[model samples]
Target: MTRFSLNQWTTRHWPMPDLLAGCAAAGVDVGLWREPVAEYGLTRTAKLVQEHGLTVTSLCRAGFFQRPDALEDNRRAIEETAALGAPVLCLVSGGLPEGSRDVDGARSRVADLLAELAPYAGEHGVQLALEPLHPMYCSDRCVVSTLAQALDMAAPFSPTQVGVMVDTYHLWWDPAVWDGIARAGAEDRIALFQVADWVTPLPEGVLTGRGMLGDGCVELRRFREAVDATGYTGPIEVEIFNDELWAMPGPAALDLALSRFAQHVV
Candidate 1:
């Protein structure tokens, strides 16, 4: 379980304090989101994590480039990530503007803005990890929807300043994922690795449809092996988003996730 990290969203409703205590007791790291961190107070949360001897694997986001204030917001996120001692800041490049159908323009904007933020991230000792959401999200959530696209965007910057995020839930459907993983490894552009199974009959809105490990058709171990083969020894974060899982007590949900992770991913 040394490499295991519980992404806070997997148990979204868990109170901050309890989540910290649980992760520390389990001897695993955590992947935190901006919302809960803001609500709990960043300084307090950082202190608590230190007191409990827990490490934060990564910070959940600083993108959504469509917003007018995205650049400023991402800069703040980089500072927050530095404060938490986290090494990576995940980026979810936001979708199109209000009614704009210029998909190419939106994607180009992501690259342009990233050029501005990558140096800032490097100065703060943080890596901007570009996450490619599933293509279905392209119209509404993320314009970068493939690993290749993410790598291409990261190519113009140093690997330490900009890297691509590898999330099984999002890349599972891409036939070129294996090759992309290899390319990322060769270029040293893999910043973070996250896992979540893709389940059928997706829930309404499709936001909370992520399945726990082993509950779906994803070859969890295969994905793990692919990442590991690239010499990526970083934390493997479990980032499921299921309503039923959130309904359970935090500790229970974590235990189940760990068990499933060991059985299917390890």
Candidate 2:
């Protein structure tokens, strides 16, 4: 199978300690989230991961530059990522400010915000990885909707300081995705690769309905091969957001994810 990494959200109901232990037992690395880390106590969480000999592939996440507290929150996230020994901090740039329809302005703000945080991330020895959500989420979830846009936001910083996440779920519908991945690789801007299939008839809030691998038309292996062709030897994070998986027991969910990842994402 591919170098699989379990994204914390994929098993959102899994307690922090169990998640770490499960990953260790499965011989898999993990991608962690801030809320769970905080709930478990950041220092303690970091220590537990270390004790389990588990690698924190990436920390999820910090962006939302439209808020006044964005900078401070992101700085803290950088510190958290460093403390956890995670090499990358995933960033989901916030959408248009309340009552505002200026998409261009929101995009511009992401560039400015990245410019400010890139240096701080570098200081903390973390790469800020910009993740572009699907276009459907452009209004309320993320202003950056395409891999190309994410790459543009990351262009100002060196790959070590800032980079892009190639998430199959979000960019699968983009015709230019292959080219965008190539450009990101050529520019040395790829930081993470996330795998999730896409299904239609999106659910309410359009956030948690991601398909299990091979359950949709995402061309999973093609995406991986393209990413690997870029010489990106990073962890392939499995980030399914389906509520069905969430309701299952953590170990069962992890087993299912691992099985699908091996069958479809390799």
Candidate 3:
């Protein structure tokens, strides 16, 4: 369980305190989201995690560069991540601005913004982890849609200040993923590795359709092996986004994720 971290969204409904206690009892770490942390009170949440002896693997996100407040928001996120003692801050680069078709421009904006924010992250002792969402979300969710692209964006920054996130759910279809993983390791650019399977007939509002481990066509173990080969000895966070899974009680969902992670991810 040393490398298994439960991403909070996998059991979205779990109350913060219970989630911390349960993860502590299960002997696993956690990946937290900003909203939930805010709701539970960041300082209090930090104290609780410390009390329970659970590590905060990474803080889930601060990007969306297209937004006007992106800079300030991301700075705050870096501070929050530091407060939680998380080493990485996941970033989801937002898509094109309203009525904009300049894909290249949007991608450029991400690079520019990362340059400005990476230093701030470094100052706060946090690594800005750029995440490449699936291309299907290109227009509205994330402009950075490939692991290679994410890597390129991080190239200008120091590895400790900026890195790319490797998520199976987003990069599974990329034939270059294995090579990308290798390159990331060689460059010391892999900040976090997240696991979630992709399923067909993606549900409407596809954001929440991520499958539990082993439930889809993703070569779960193969991906794990490839990542391990990269010399990355970091947490493999389970970040499934399924409604059905969310409906289950928190403990039940955690149990299922743990079981599947052991069977399919390990």
Report clashes for each candidate as comma-separated counts.
0, 0, 0
| Local accuracy of candidate 1 as per-residue lDDT tens digits, 136-226 | 8998999999999999999999999999999999999999999999999999999999999999998888899999999998998999999
Q: What TM-score fits each model?
A: 0.99, 0.98, 0.99
Whole-model lDDT, candidate 3?
Answer: 0.94
For candidate 1, list the clashing residue pairs, or say none: none
Q: Judging by lDDT, tell me the better candidate of 1 and 2.
A: 1
Instruction: Report model 3's TM-score to 2 decimal places.
Output: 0.99
- Write the candidate numbers in order of decreasing lDDT: 1, 3, 2
Cα lDDT, all candidates: 0.95, 0.93, 0.94
Q: Which one wins by TM-score: 2 or 3?
A: 3
Please, what are the lDDT tens digits per residue for candidate 2 over residues 1-266?
34899999999999999999999999999999999999899999999998999999999989988888998999999999999999999999988899998999999989998888889999999999999999988998899999998887787788899999899999998999999999999999989999999998899989988999999999999999999998998899999999899999999999999999889878
Cα displacement (Å) at residue 212, model 2: 0.6
Query: 1-266, model 3: which lDDT tens digit per residue?
Result: 77999999999899999999999999999999999999999999999999998899999989999999999999999999999999999999999999999999999999899989988998999999999999999999899999888888899999999999999999999999999999999999999999999998899988889998988999989999998998999999999999999999999999999999999988
Screening candidate 2 with a backbone cut-off below 3 angstroms (N, C-alpha, C), the clashing residue pairs are: none
Worst 10 residues of 1 by lDDT: 202-211
